[model samples]
Target chain A: MSYIMLSYTDLLLASLLLMINGVLSVIFSLGLLKRLVIAVTRMVVQLLLVGSILSWLFAAPSPFWTLLAAFVMVAFAGYEIVSRQDRPLKGFWSAGLGAGSMTVASMVIVLLALTTQIRPDPWYHPQYMIPILGMILGNTMTGVSLGLNTLTNAVRREAGAIEAGLILGMSRHKAMQGVIRQSLRNGLMPLINAMSVMGLVSLPGMMTGQILAGAAPQEAVKYQILIMFLISGATGFGVIISVLGASLRLSDNRHRLRLDRLASGNGK
Target chain B: MLEIVNLHRPGLSPVSLRIDDGECLALMGPSGSGKSLILRAVADLDPNEGRVRANGDERSQTPAPLWRQKVGFLPAQPGWWGESVGDHIEKSDSVLDLLHKLHLPDESLNWPVSRLSTGETQRLALIRLLAHAPKVLLLDEPTSALDEEARKSVEALLKAQLSNGVSILLTTHDKKQANRLCQRIFHINKGVVTEAFS
Candidate 1:
């Protein structure tokens, strides 16, 4: 059987359908037109900038340049995660370190383990490494931010109980166990739900993209399964590290909750 | 025992007060007299320019969590830290007994907090705090929301707890309640604490 490839006109019609759908969504939604416009504009600008950069990176892929670009992406994502919470720059370094380490480790491991036959020049392949690392780091960043917020807020809200526990001969760490557990659950819920509904409720973006790029349906499905599993693992590890690391900054040497500093917007 | 030294608000003279262990000290003052501020400062719930020590340990030296646990605070309007009433009580076994003593039924554990009357919620909050068994009890108009009978019952229950070796420091605008509940009274005026009666 021969497959009929879509012509330029068909592509144009497809693009127009997306635009019309967006417009219709904006019209039917209440108080969302401005937000929709802003989001669309932001997407256009960001994609255009990234498109240019990726084009250049792919044209001349060097190890040094590729690593530098990845570092830059991680740094920006780290800053964004911190800035989004209106938190201080204190956690910026930690977040950057966490994101950088996790993304690079996962990307390298997956690439080496799966795509070892790709080529001799493997570490800096823009097509495979960049997109995969971007997805992993982006999800990890979100997990960190969510975990951090949930942990901090939980500690604050339950400060009284925590104190009660401490007075009852519980150690500081023991007192914080509840908050930590709750934060972990809250952080991991999205990833868990996504995993639960992987194929039934929605087609994941990576698999959909791979299929659209003409990969076999079976191959795309396998990759999707691998990526989702990896993402969940990365997210879990990232959230735990971020929470534990962030908690260190929130207490004093005596293991007391340093509310004065964490509060009053100083941590931000 | 609790002590406050140089506790002063802006544009006011320093105020000082000391309460012995197991003593019920009533703080009485008009509005804006800074009575509540003293209770908050002692509880370490407010930032202030003063020194507070619980059982001879300075605020900074003592662990705040330990201090807070030992010091039960009932604010004028209690704030629930959880979504449900049962969530606050599920951690311990004595919460049921306290709830019963406070005249709240077992079914109240499942009732949405929004549905509770101010008086009932206040009682529930008191019971919640009491379950922790703090060494010092700080009451900031704790009975302000209750009816006359409820107020009397609460006062009697608190009076009975004096033998439990807990220090009680309270603030109230009601002179009659103050006379009935406290062995000593301190009147705050413009941030200055003065011994009004003993």
Candidate 2:
């Protein structure tokens, strides 16, 4: 089977389908016309730019390029985590915690997968490295962001209860145990749900894309399973690191809840 | 016994005070006068420049959890994290007695925390503190939410604690209540602590 490349004309045909969405917005007075148009435009530009970058990356296949690509993705994810918070930690701590943990978890998992499961030449081959890192980092970033956001908000809301825990003979770690557990659950819940209903509810993105790209169903299933496991590992590691780090940073060794370390109240 | 030497924080004057074994000291101050500040500092819940010694155990040297358990502090509106009263207030043989003493029924232990009245919450917070029986109690208006009769029952509970050699540092705006329970009263205004005449 030959993989037929999508031409610019075929892309234009896809754009026509988006017109149906625009038509509905206009009919219902949903006021989504502007946003829909802008979003679709941005999506097109961004994805095309990414495609161009990947072409360059695949052409050169330098370790330096791969490293730069990974760093850039992680850095953006770090900022996204901070911006998503309702009450983010003050100053550099937010960015540091998110980015630092993401780098640790996503990089480690991707490297392990590359070495042990799919041994590509030079180990940092852009073909495999970029997509795996992208998938892992995307999910891991969400997990870390949700965990940190939920944690800070919960801590702020439960200030009295947490202090009570401290006064009730609980260590700082012990006092934060409940919140940490909840945050971890919040972070990993999506992965859990997705994994449980993987094939029945909806086909996973990688599997669908691989099958669409003419890969055999059996082979595509293998890659999808491997990717899902990689994502799960990355998400768990990422959430734990960020949540634990946030809990520790927001409290002191004295078991006191240092709410002042947080930047103001809720953003909304 | 508890001793605080020159405890100072932002917007608070340096405070030095002592409570003997089985003694009660009252800190009298209006709202925002740093009454809770002093209690928090003594409890090591906040960063402050001070030396707090409880039963010859220096606060800085002891583990924070141990120190807090030793020097228990309750805020004006104690926080309840659990869903039910029993979750916040531990069950014990003495706890049942304390509940009856505070005029709360045994069923209150099963009551949802959200169902508790302000007065009940305050009383239950007291019971929560008493559950561990800290060596020192830094209470911030422990009876502020209670009515006259309820207040009387809480006072009885404190008196029993005192006789058991538990020292207390109570903050209150009610002079009559302070006079009734505290052996010494210190008035605080604008961060200043001066002996108040009974």
Candidate number with greatest DockQ: 2
DockQ score of each predicted structure, in the order shown: 0.12, 0.79
* TM per candidate, chain B: 0.91, 0.96
Worst 10 residues of 1 chain A by lDDT: A85-94
Q: Which residues of candidate 1, in runs, are more than 4 Å off? A: A1-13, A18-49, A79-125, A145-183, A211-219, A242-268, B6-15, B31-33, B46-51, B56-61, B80-115, B131-133, B163-165, B189-198
The C-alpha local distance difference test score for the whole of candidate 2 amounts to 0.90
lDDT of 2 by residue, B58-98 (tens): 98899999988888888888887679888877788899999
Q: Output candidate 2 Cα RMSD.
A: 1.7
Which runs in model 2 stand beyond 4 Å of their true positions?
A265-268, B194-198
Residue B122's C-alpha lDDT in candidate 1?
Answer: 83
Best by lDDT: 2
Local lDDT at B159 for model 2: 92
TM-score of candidate 1 against the unseen true structure:
0.72
Please give the C-alpha DockQ score of model 2: 0.79
